[model samples]
Target: MHQAIPYRTWIHANTRDSRDLPLAVRGAGVDSASVAKLVSENAVIVIGRRGCCMCHVIKRLLQGLGVNPPVYEVDEHHEAAVAAHLGAATVQFPAVFVGGKLFGGLERVMATHISGELVPILKDAGALWL
Candidate 1:
């Protein structure tokens, strides 16, 4: 039988300890702390899985609305960490942060857009022009 490497432990087994690696180095270039920091530093940012369709949809939607948010694509390992930091009830991909706050997922975004509040929110976030 063959064994597999545990997540975030893709480094060679001979390495002293995975903990020695920086948080960003341990996995997909993001730790929970980095994710939190990214949210706080940006007016708007979307943290989503690398190849997720919802991520694409969210990005396109924001662009269509004249808001270009920085989309940080994380791999699956980083996704769960980000989700927990985002405080979502479940794993929500393409988690939106507006004005340095969690703005929920795709459904919430769609609802806000339908309600005509997305533009105002984007304006407040400084992600869109007046």
Candidate 2:
């Protein structure tokens, strides 16, 4: 026997890894503090796709940093086009933006944090640990 599933759920789950999140390749001039502030305030959107490992890692990293980010699925939202274009990315999975600026992908995010750039950014953004 076969199991049944909801159409919307199926679509969302299946499109989790679809090419729709545009990420900036040249790395935009985004300060980590700006991102931390937005995420901490839950004002910025954390664009992500379901079933994406990189996306998951980004979320975990943000959480580790004590940031509760607002998540959005680019492929599921038409307005994402504006962000994608502004981000200058090719709709890659897991695109993070803060204060209307593209903050690059997981690799960049991790690198910044490891290089001790994330803390200062988060602190300036008023989202870092006291």
Candidate 3:
């Protein structure tokens, strides 16, 4: 018999620690503290563009899972700053965060869901009642 590890610890161990990441991927206007605070307080957060199709898909997926994640639409000027703060390159939209940890983008979320791990993670993060 194997003991199951809590999703938070499992996620922390699986994902790269944001603290060890460089201040900014693009090296400009990155406020690490603000990014950290936003993620920490929100059980789930999706930062994406208002008109991006992929962003819509991500939001829909979360909603289908019974999650009500906050979405922050990135404006042109703040795009770089948000990307850098999240340690993401090239201003990727729809960055996902769960339980105050960076959970990558749509592909990662989909992969986790396909692997049947997303529900446990959502439950652990208090984003799911079931």
Candidate 4:
């Protein structure tokens, strides 16, 4: 199944290596420039406090939709900084970005999924190949 596999599997495979990131790469207020690069670079990202259950929910939903987004599990102290970098007014746990833009949190994600729009959105975001 690895052969001709969609990008979802690849994203999930890489998610396990997050623990290897050095402290500097973890946060320290998550410098705006680096945050910009992160949002611009990935098709989908889940920014939330480390070990947040809501973040896990978002990730699982995406995976169920065939999109395994790489999450940036930030520290609580840096949520505001990350939120500002993403152009949001306030910090929202499990803040999701799709196609390099803020896609809101669990509420928006679940709404989109229940409405049957998530798969197409993931496809358009290039996070889903099938």
The estimated TM-scores of all candidates read 0.71, 0.54, 0.67, 0.76
TM-score of 2: 0.54
| Top-scoring candidate (TM-score) | 4
- Report clash pairs, candidate 4: none
**Deviation from native of the Cα of residue 22 in model 2, angstroms:** 23
List model 3 lDDT by residue over 45-104, tens digit each: 777754567876887888888886766555567777777777667646678888977788
TM-score for candidate 4? 0.76
- For model 4 the local lDDT of residue 49 reads 81
Q: Once superposed on the true structure, which residue ranges of model 3 sit more than 4 Å away at CA?
A: 1-35, 87-91
Residue pairs with colliding backbones in model 1 are none
| Worst lDDT 10-window in candidate 1 | 18-27
Compare the candidates by lDDT and give the number of the best one. 4
- Across 32-62, the per-residue lDDT of candidate 4 in tens digits comes to 7767776677788887787788987888888
> On residues 1-130, what C-alpha lDDT tens digit does candidate 2 reach at each position?
9999753322221222323322211112233343334333433346555455676677678778877554544344433453444446474557676545566777778899899897677666554556
Residue by residue across 1-130, what tens digits does model 1's lDDT show? 8999766413321233433432122225555666666667667777677767897788789889987666666777666666776666575776788998888889999999999999998898888876
Candidate with the larger lDDT of 1 and 4: 4
Better model by lDDT, 1 or 3? 1
